[model samples]
Target: MKLRVENFGPISYADVEIKPLTVLIGKNNAGKSMLAQLIFTLMTLTEGYIPRRFLTSMLQHIRTTEDFIAPYLRQVDDLRKKIKEAREITHLSCVKMVVDMIIEYLTQYLNKTLGDFLERYFAMELKSLVNLYSDYTRVECAYSKYSIAEFTITKDGNLSAKFDIKMMDELIDNILKDEETNKLINRVIRSRGGRDFTSTIAAIEKIAEFIFPKRPLLSTLYIPAGRAGLLEGYEAVSSALIALASTAPLKGISVPPIPGMAYEFYSLLLQLTGRKGPFEKMSDLFKEVIEGEIVFEELKLPKSKMVYRFKFKDKESSVDLIHAASMVKELSPIYLVLRELVDKGYLLIIEEPESHLHPAAQVKLMEIFAQLVNEGLEILITTHSDILLRKLAHLVMEGLTGGRANANLKPEDVAVYLLKPDEKGYVTREVNILEEMPTFDEVIEQLYEEERNLCYLSLQREMNEASPRNF
Candidate 1:
């Protein structure tokens, strides 16, 4: 996929073709993080599954046919009364006739309802994108399959949206069919029989899935730069918030709003510290770099309050995660995700993996990243570490010669962008990789010039000391 950003944040213009392994290198505050967050938000808003709350709310309140079919049946009052009366019948042939009539009347209603829901869903997503990037007056994003969604905010603070509904209508017809609608009708009928509604809920869930397919390939996880600080205070702060929230209903206290990004990060931390999944085996590279495993412990209180603590486990002993080495805390979240959350074909956006890590450890981490890419995991990283870039260069070289073990990464698989700010605004330029190495010669040339100037100054000083003074 290609992402083009103009007049967003510090970026005046940038058009990047995302690769399997994309790297962004620049000085701090050069708009790299802004670009990454924008991509994450767009991918998530467009391709993610339907919101669980929206689906559950629709199912709970709109259970009976009367709930959604009422408007359509308002004029046909006698027919509606007859349909309600037919619900009490027991004979098979009579019931089938009533069901067939109801289905015939509800076909157009169901199609309209589903179509309106989809339009509103896409509209809501576009509004959210506008709110997230409010500074930019104009923004545009287009997916490979979906049409372009554009937004403009005028000087009067009025927002306008231009979106095409033609593709969405076609998608609805292909994924949601009349057969599924019939199944929904049957499930609703069964729900009215005093039987458990599990099957009905399941049927609704399937319909929702087809309408909003899960993002199989573009599944993403963002590991922010503030992870260390967040990890340190996660337990205490989260417990306090939970306790307060739990008592708010009883005490009549108002609950304040939490930042969305903070909430997402906290949720990720909780998942990491919650349970063990199928992928419990840590890879050899992770073991070599971390030298330990993550362990979660549960604590029970008198009032049925349960608190969880995260720790590190080695061959000798276990220690609290907060007190463990900085590198451990920095890398634990990533390890937990790869071990438990992700299986294959995921996009991982990491701000800086080399944070608080030794130079050697940083190189090792890049090697592991290469291995992950070979195993079908796409990565997007923003870094200022020359060491990490050099390590990647060496890996590319090794891959070229076929001398590296399990080194499936080639020069074509990687894309590097150098971000810098000029008088106009920030710009992103794709750096060329020649002979299996990145062209960072500009940086090297600057260093060489500085050294040469110092040498010239030293020689001039020595000559003055040997010569006689003119005073």
Candidate 2:
């Protein structure tokens, strides 16, 4: 998907295409996290099985076939007539009708979900989302040739979003032409002697796949900065909520507002289950990086409590995650979330994945990320670490050289964008991940030149001193 933004938060302009392993590199307060959160919000808006839920309700609410079919008939009159005639229903126009109806409902759904997510993610600083100098702000995510999700913020703080139906039509048309969908459509057509609700439901479910593909899920998650601190606090709050058996009392007390992503992660931690996800074994990668494993263990000796314990390779015993090292705390969520919740289709947005890690560890972490992408996991990260970027470049080169294909990254698989402040506001530009990492200040380059010049000057002085006649 291509994400375009104008005057969003501190961002003046950004047009980026998200790849499998996307990275946002920039200085502080450059609107990297804001942009990431915006993407997260849009994906979350469409999360869950939107089609199934809406269709179930629609079926319940519609008293007759006309109540449901009349709205879309205008756009697909030919297709409807063909179905009624029991002819081969091969019209692509039905895809358009389905997409339009989906967007109609999606717009209504997003009006509230979008606002709630913004409030949670931005912490009630809605005005700050608009650029002060600009008349309006716009954010859009376009898939295929058309935009599916878009947001607009006027200078007066009026917020609205438009979800266009002109998205993935061609792709959905192909899906509608699939053999299974074709059979389902034919079955519905043959049973047209009244509203065969069962066949109609099945046909619409197939049509719904046009709007919501099964490959990449609509749900996306964000891993915020200072995750170690946040996770430590989340652990404490989990216990308090369990002990109190209600969060009503805590609501009255004043506490810092946690961003929506952190809060969501906290909630996810509370929902640990015994059934493992498809990617559960990926936790071993994190264990290698942290040199320890953070295991979710339940203790019933004292009382039933869920605890996260960090166990090192060399150690015989494990300690609670809060008492573990900062690096361990920072990485535990990555492990837990991967091993517990998400599978290949979920996009994981990590604000600063390299936080509180050594240089070598950060490099190893990059390899892990590359391997994960190669293994079909999607990741979007915001980083200021040159080590990670350089290592990524190396991996890309390795991919080119046909070495380490397992942990390798193709140039197309990785997209690095440079987000930095301009005179007016922060602007984003796509960077070449395979090239030398871009440096904002070039301080390191200047120091390297200075060192080279100093070395030459020292050599010249020694030669002059050795040559007594020249002196």
Candidate 3:
């Protein structure tokens, strides 16, 4: 997918092409996080799975006049009584003609009403996709295309329908005449099928789902850098609250709203504490790399309430996640999500995965990420760690050489963007990777120059010491 952002936060303009394993490396406050957040927000809003109940409710409200045939018949009966009192009509044929005219008029009106309702509904739904952008920034994301339904009333008093899929219009032209259209519309509106409502709705829903099936909603799990600090205090605060509540029954203690990044971290923490799933391989991998496994314990509180505490367990003992090594606390969220929440084809964004970890651990984490990418997980990371970058490049080379088991990520599979600031705000450029290695000559050269300067200073100091002092 390609994401284009203009005037968003610190970024003036950036057009980024996202690959399976995307890396953004730059200095602090360089708008790397801004781009990551933009991708997350867009995917969350546009491609997230919508509840079936919401769709059903919207469908139910789309009613046609034929669904209210009894009311129209009642109106006709009332009119007939009024006409009879005003003037006596001796001919039964004339009364039949008037009733037919009323029915025809009502059917036409209902068909137009149904058509209008469908047009407005479909248009409004399609319009919502464009509202993902903020006022200060313009964002566009291209993904799999889907069809939108269009309804039109033909000049011959018939209902016409079309499915606009990828600009290829599949027209069901003049599919229903006035009366037939009314009946069809009524069937759809009332959901009257299986000779009644249920089957009719089921069929309609099937068609709708086919044309606009849930767009492979990419589940984005973002592990923020502040998770360690949050995890430390979460246990103490929750335990204290539980203890206080046990003394006396508290009334109306509700969860306060957590804003911004805090909310994201809290939500992930909550998911971690909930039911654990079977991800033994991933759990074992975490243990192998981090030397510990995340263990959650359920505490039964008063009033039959249950709360959970996350802790790190080694071979010997279990420690509160807060007191565990900094690396363990920092990587706990990643382990928990991979073990329970994340699955194949989900997007996992981590901000500075190298935080609070040794260089060796950081490199090992990158190797794990490579394995994840090979196993169908899409990962995006923003980092300032050269260790992580070097590790990734080495993995690509190893994959190419067929040395790693089932790990094959090509250079093209990884996209590295370097974010930097110029005179005009911040801009991002894609870094070139040649022969399965990313080019970082400028950084390497700068490091060499610094080393050379240090060596020259040392030599000058030695020479001055060897010579006798002039004084």
Best by TM-score: 2
List the candidates' TM-scores in order.
Answer: 0.66, 0.83, 0.65
Q: What is the lDDT of residue 427 in candidate 1?
A: 74
| TM-score (C-alpha) between model 1 and the true structure | 0.66
lDDT of each: 0.61, 0.74, 0.58
| Candidate with more favorable, higher TM-score: 1 or 3 | 1
N/CA/C clash count, model 1: 0
lDDT for each residue of candidate 1 in 253-309, tens digit (9 for 90 to 100): 776654555565677666664455433453446767876766655444544433333
Q: In candidate 3, which residue ranges exceed 4 Å CA deviation? A: 47-135, 145-218, 236-257, 298-314, 435-444, 468-471
lDDT of 2 by residue, 1-471 (tens): 788999988899999888899999888888888888887776666654344544555658855455344433332343345456644334354444445555765576567567667877677556668888788888887743544778887877677887775636566757666988777666655564235555555566666566555444434767788888987788578666565556656667444555667777777667666356788777578878889777668878677966778888888799988899999888877778788777886788998899999999999999999888887888999998888888889999999999977888899988999987888798998888665577633757888999999999999999988997875
Score residue 19 of candidate 3 by CA lDDT.
Answer: 86
Would you list the clashing residue pairs of candidate 1?
none
Ten-residue stretch with the least lDDT total in model 1: 117-126
Candidate 3 per-residue lDDT, tens place, 1-471, comes to 676655555666677877889999777787887678656654454332132333354468855345444433444344344434544332232223333333343345434453333233222222221222223434444432333323333323245333233432231122122344334335533421224434333332233333333433436777777678877777665556556665544555554434445556666666664555544475566776667676665545444434433444445556656777878888878888888777777889999999998998987888788888887788999988878887777777776787767555687889888877766567788876443223356677888999999999999999898878934
